[model samples]
Target: MRVAILASGNGTNFEALTKHFQSGDIPGDEVLLFCNHPDAPVMKRAERLGVPHESFTVKECGGKEKYEQRLLKLLKQYKVDIIALAGYLRVVGPTILNEYPDSILNLHPALLPSYPGLNSIQRAFDDYKKGKIKETGVTVHFIDAHLDHGPIIAQKAVPIKADDTEASLESRVHDTEHVLFPAALKKVILERMNKQ
Candidate 1:
């Protein structure tokens, strides 16, 4: 399936997905990258990986409506079958979500139904420190209009160590994300292919 990744940060998940697709571990086609920040490092990573990427700033686009319209146009131009959000900070508006619906997927750093928004990893770590929970993990889920509240596709837990700090916990969660996101994408793509 054709996949478009939207990221606004380092794009480690984007890199992982590209490598997985290159190795034929995940069946994908015509992968594209999109970022809202003009200077986001993901743009550079996209360049190095030979993936076509586009960026738009709020001021350049005028507003969210026009920005998402341009994004929709690009998605259509590339015939993207799925939209994967990786570290994208902005909340997707109705324009894209309505257009893609269940085809859009996101990888969250915390197991959902608990820590659901920004700084989830740190929140989970804090909760653990307070003895509120023992483990936290990554979740791959379908993206809805709500932030990080969607049907989960896959999840894998990482136990909190007694000596774990926020950074170490974040590292382990990222490792889980790199693995789980691709697997979830593969499953979503395979299901799409089968239904067609």
Candidate 2:
């Protein structure tokens, strides 16, 4: 499979995906990294990993339509088969989503139908404080137009510890993501890979 990672944060998950797709169990022909934020730490990780990366935000491209047009052009140029959204903060527009369809996968920090948006880990911890839940988990889902509301590919729960801080819980969740994402992606890729 030819894979590309779209991310916006510190790039730990981006790094994880790049490395995992390059070798280990499920290898790919090439793995690329693209970011909306040019200066995000993930760009640095991309440089360190020797992965080719491209950058341009919606504002940089002038608007959503233009931005997605540029993104679509790039994806076509690379012949990307799978788009893994690791930590990308932006909601993918219809253009790219329509182009890629089920080929795009989103990694979220909390189980679906629970904390679906930003600060999910913090929200889960807060809910625990409120005695509303006992555990939260990571989810790898096929993204649609909605935010983190898509068909689930895989999920793994992480129990809340009484002594655990929100930061600690986030750490554990990230660790789980690193494990779950690649495994789920391997399945998705092999299952959906276009037949020659």
Candidate 3:
């Protein structure tokens, strides 16, 4: 399977996936790393890992539709079988979703159906502080038109300790995401191959 990664930030998850691929633990090729920000750390990571990287700024595009159209074109050009979003902040428009459907997966820091949007880590911490929730974790799900509403492929809970600060809790969640995302992708890739 050929895979592409889209990220907007530090690309810790991107690095995790790359490591998995390099180790031959994941049964797929990472064809490219695409980012909206040229200065995103993921781009640097990609260079260090010798993975082909590309950047497309939405600011350069005339509209959201055009931006997404270009993105779709790039994905198609690479013949990417799977698309992974790591710390990708922008809402993916319909073009990409309709083009790939369940093929695109996103790693969310907080457990889904709660803290669905930005500041998920901080929000979960706040909820824990209020004694409203007992646990928080990571979720890997297919991307849908509705933000973070896609079918969940996998999720694992991490307990929020009494002494846990937002940073501490986020650290655990990030660790979980790094572990879970690769495992989930490995499953998906194996399942697809089995179907063939």
Candidate 4:
């Protein structure tokens, strides 16, 4: 399977995916790495891994529709089979979601329907402090028009310890994401091949 990764941050998950692909833990290859931020660390990771990388600024595109159009054009140019969102902060528009449907996957730091947006780990910690939340976890799901409301493909819980700080809980959640994301991608690739 040919995969493309979209990221806007430090790219820890991106690094994990590339490491797994390099070590043969995942059968697919990362054909491209695209970043919205020019200085995103994922671009450096892609360079270090010798994978082709591209960048586009949402500002340059003038609007979400035009930006997504450019993105879809690039995905088509590479014949990208799967688009993985790794620390990609933007909510993908309906156009890409409609075109790819279940083919686009996102890795969320916390379990679904709980802490759905940015700073999920911190939000979970706050909720726990207020006695509103009992558990926190990572979720891998397909992308849809709604934010983080797509069908969940995989999830793994990370218990919040009584004395756990936000940073500690976040670390655990990220570790789980690193493990679960690759496994889910591998399964998706295998399932696609089987259907063929």
Candidate 5:
């Protein structure tokens, strides 16, 4: 399987996915790193990892429609079979969603249906601080049009320590995502392949 990672942040998850795929521990070829922000640090990591990369913002492409058209074209160019969103913040429009369908996956920092959308880590930590919740975790799921409201592929609960700050809890959640995302992706793809 050929996979493309769409990311916006520090690219730690992007880096993890690249290494996992390259190591042959996972059964896919990570052929591209697609970034919505041209200057995102993930592009730098992609260069170091020797993975081909492409980037352009929606504004740079004129609008979301045109941007998605270009995005679809690029995916076709790579013959991409999967799109894994690491930290890509933008909502995926219908064009790409219709093209990839269930082939798109996203990693959310909080155990979702509770804290969906942005700032989820902080929200979960706040809930914990208020004694409203005991733990927060990571979730890897198939993304739909709804933000973070997709069908879950995998989830792992990360306990909140009494001494844990938001940063500590966030670090553990991220680590869990790094592991879970790749495994969940591999599982999804393998299942898809077998059904073919």
Candidate 6:
């Protein structure tokens, strides 16, 4: 299936997904990268990986509806069947959500139903520092209109060590994310293929 990735910052997850698909670890067709920030590093990564990419600002499109309309148009042009949100900061509107439905997935740093929004890794680490929680991990789920409130497809927890700092915990969580995101996508792909 054709896959598109949306990213806003450092595209480590984007790079991981590209590499996974390149290595035949996951079944997907050409990947197109989309970035909200024109100067985002993800564009560079996409170029390096030889993937098609586009950068746009919501303001430039006049409004969310127009921006989403443009994005939807692009996805349709590529015949994209799946979308991955990797560190993509903007909340997805119904335009794309309705078009893709459960086909769009996002990877969050902390296990969902625990920390559900931005700065999740840092927040979870802070909670651990305060002895409020013992562990945190990553979650992969469908993208809904709600922020990080979609149905979870997969999750893996990582225990926080007493000596773990926020940075260390975050590193481990990122590692978990790299592994889990592709696995989750693979499951989604297999299910879609089976349904067809």
RMSD of each: 0.9, 1.3, 0.8, 1.0, 0.9, 1.0
- Candidate of highest lDDT: 3
Backbone clash tally (model 4)? 0
TM-score for all models, in order of appearance: 0.97, 0.96, 0.97, 0.96, 0.97, 0.97
- Per-residue lDDT over 59-138 for candidate 1, one digit per residue giving the tens place of the 0 to 100 score: 79888899889889989998998999999998999999999989899988888878888889889988998899999999
Give the C-alpha lDDT of model 3.
0.91
Q: What is the lDDT of residue 173 in candidate 5?
A: 89
Better of 1 and 2 by TM-score: 1
TM-score: model 2 vs. ground truth:
0.96
Q: For candidate 2, lDDT tens digit of each residue in 67-93?
A: 999999999899998899989999999
User: Candidate 1: lDDT of 94?
Assistant: 96
**Per-residue lDDT of 1-196 in model 4, one digit per residue for the tens?**
8999999989899999989888988887889999999898888988988888999998999988999999999999999999999999999998788888799999998889778888889988999999998899999999888888888989999999998988888888889999999999888888998898
Model 3, span 1-196: residue lDDT tens: 9999999989999999999999999998999999999998889999999999999788798778888999989999999999999888899988888888789989998789888988988988898899899899999999888988899999999999999988899899999999999999998888988988
> Mind sharing the TM-score for model 6?
0.97
Q: After superposition, how far is residue 59 of candidate 1 from its true place, in Å?
A: 2.0
Model 1 lDDT at residue 30? 44
Q: Backbone collision count in every prediction?
A: 0, 0, 0, 0, 0, 0
